[model samples]
Target: MASSSGLLPSEPRTLPSTGFQVVDASETIEEETLPGYHLGKYYPVRLGEIFDKRYRVVGKLGYGTTSTVWLAHDSVESRYVALKLYVANLNNTRELKAYECLDEADEKDHPGKTLIRKLLGSFQVDSHSSNGSSSHLCLVHEPLGPSLKEILDLMPPYSFHLGFLRPVLRNILIAVDFLHARAGIIHSDLQIANFICDVRSSDKAMFAKFENAEFTQPTPRKIISEEHIIYTSRRMSLSKALPLLCDFGETRLFSEAGTPGEDIMPNVYKAPEVIMHMEWDYKVDVWNVAMVVWHSLTGRPLFNGRSADGKIQDDRIHMAEMVALMGPPPLRFLERSTRMTRALWNEDGNWKNVAPIPDITLEKLGADINGYDKEGFFLFFRRMLRWLPEDRPTCEELVYDPWLMRELGLGLGR
Candidate 1:
């Protein structure tokens, strides 16, 4: 069951084949369509070859930076499953080390590895490149919904229902807590864009009811379509209680040893301590959770900057915007910043590492200003976006927040 936020059905967009594609043009097209230039129309391994020949690849479901997901049917199990194949580039020592570490930890610490993307199974498959020296390795998982970012983009003035919001936030928080508090990992890339709705059988029932609205008894075809739609809409609710902290491509193990710096993450959700290269920890994940919750409540990202180029200037622009909304970093915090930020501090006591917030102001333009009705949503935003990392709430505090408690109806954990 695949749960999607905002997908409108349309004819698949076809690309014109160029005899010799230029690097620049190919780069642009690849970025917009596929993450890489190699989008195989048909690959070497289909459903029949893997999982002891029980699964059959039906069609492509989704794509990502390092993998392509295909919807598959398990013949023996009589069910649909998702097959995620890792890109060949990830077969190197760096990624291999991380994968080995995660696999070992999952068996020992997590056992089921329930919160993050479950590694259904992994196997090596033959490659079909011009130079087929190496084979591809793929992992299997249940299908997930369109990312929160994609969902928001498709919706008009993007918004999530309270029914959806409360549970989703709960799930995200718990997942983060597990990653930081339990697994000793930090999901460096924590954002609405990374959250996927995990839909399953219950959606079929909801769709049945919805389809039956038009007729005393709806046709099988109509019911099936409705079921698919409902499945897409509500698969991975926070109520499901699944740990779905995904995009571990940026994840890092932060023991007493130390943590990686801002260089590892996208500029938007990065913590100030990371920007300043200070001793950071789980609180950074908390900051990211706050940003995700804010996006969930309001359909807009709290710290979106104009620098899509992912440059240091863009980071600066993002930081300045954050400072404007949340206030300047504390003097003590600033005193500890690296020379980069020290040289960047502005007259307003805000770090000059960032420029003035761009003309694209969320409040002034009402771009990211929706869904403010829930109590303390703004307060949550204010707290999370504190210029000083120490000023931010811990994951434990956020889990027990009044706003979260009231909205989630977890007064006594009944």
Candidate 2:
């Protein structure tokens, strides 16, 4: 039956009896084996299921611990949007508040604002199941393509070209600047996975093809019970690539200063202040941006925090690597959190030898690029990778760094 909007067919699309494969129940499907996954947790979304009487679910995009994202057609607007449906009873008010903070900023002319993925709308959905009735919060956003890491993985060498990397890093810096300066927010998590390619005009065609494929081929899915069905995620095809910083689940808001003593950021990208349990602010993001840029240029992580067995994360090992690369933390820097500092360092600002420092330097590691480019690259890294968070350059300053501008073939004037 045609919906009242007359833009989508609200009835569920019938799948072919023989064409599509039925996944075995015993095998782990998309989110079936997730730690907290159970009946009534994730909304049992089906193809062609309409939400809010407007968005028609077309295909599964991806899933995370807190939510499952789907590609949906907005019948009211006649555009494709990504519906991020959170797990039942998940507290996502922080993420919503971060978006609101960005929205409140008066920076329409800010270049970084465009490089950030925008929240179009949001609503709540009620799901009734054998377990109980639960409400899930759903956020609507413009559908985007694969992440920078995913795109890099698809191509051989799995690293971005210097030419392409320049603009991508610049865009990221701009986005970070907007978050720090204009929006009064801190994106505590900044990594390659959080940087995604924007959907272009050419990429919009992929959505129609995805919908058509769902109608004819139907995604292979595991049917566990009446309340649960797990569908394989479908990747969106993207021809034109533009970087957009996304994922605000770990974002924190700071007005005029810093937020202290809160553990944030992924292990590999943690700032020195974060490790020492001291006050941290926008500079932590600066450190994160440096690590991300370094990782993008080289396939390997700049700092590997894993234990020798690679079974668990060891902060001592991570600090050892940091000292070896960036030199030992200064006495004053260590004094910020005396208790935590004493555990890792001596009175003279020397490492306590819980883990041996790796015999590596930035100069030795970044040996690929030659001469001027190498010098400039390391200079840029020096500006951000400091032992003290306050020593790191602001995102605004990094955006106009000589090395980045020269690589992008832009003058300081621009």
lDDT of 1: 0.54
| Candidate 2: worst-modelled 10 consecutive residues by lDDT | 1-10
Question: Which lDDT tens digits does candidate 2 get at residues 116-209?
Answer: 9999999999988787888999999888888887787787677776667877888999999999889899898999989988866645666767
What TM-score does prediction 1 earn?
Answer: 0.69
**Least accurate stretch of 10 residues (summed lDDT) in model 1?**
222-231
lDDT of candidate 1 over 1-414, digit per residue (tens): 222311211221222222222233223322125534443322333322344465555444455566666555455554555676666645533334345555656344432245556545556665555434445666656555556776666667577665467657766776676665556776667887677755545542332232222233211110112111101111222223333656666666775423535475666666777767776766777778866766765776667665656543455676677666656667777666556566668545665444665544334533444443433555555666666666777665676766668665665332
TM-score of each: 0.69, 0.91
Judged by whole-model lDDT over C-alpha atoms, candidate 2 comes out at: 0.82
In model 2, the Cα lDDT at residue 113 comes to: 88
User: What are the lDDT figures for the candidates, one per model?
Assistant: 0.54, 0.82
Position 57, candidate 2: lDDT: 88
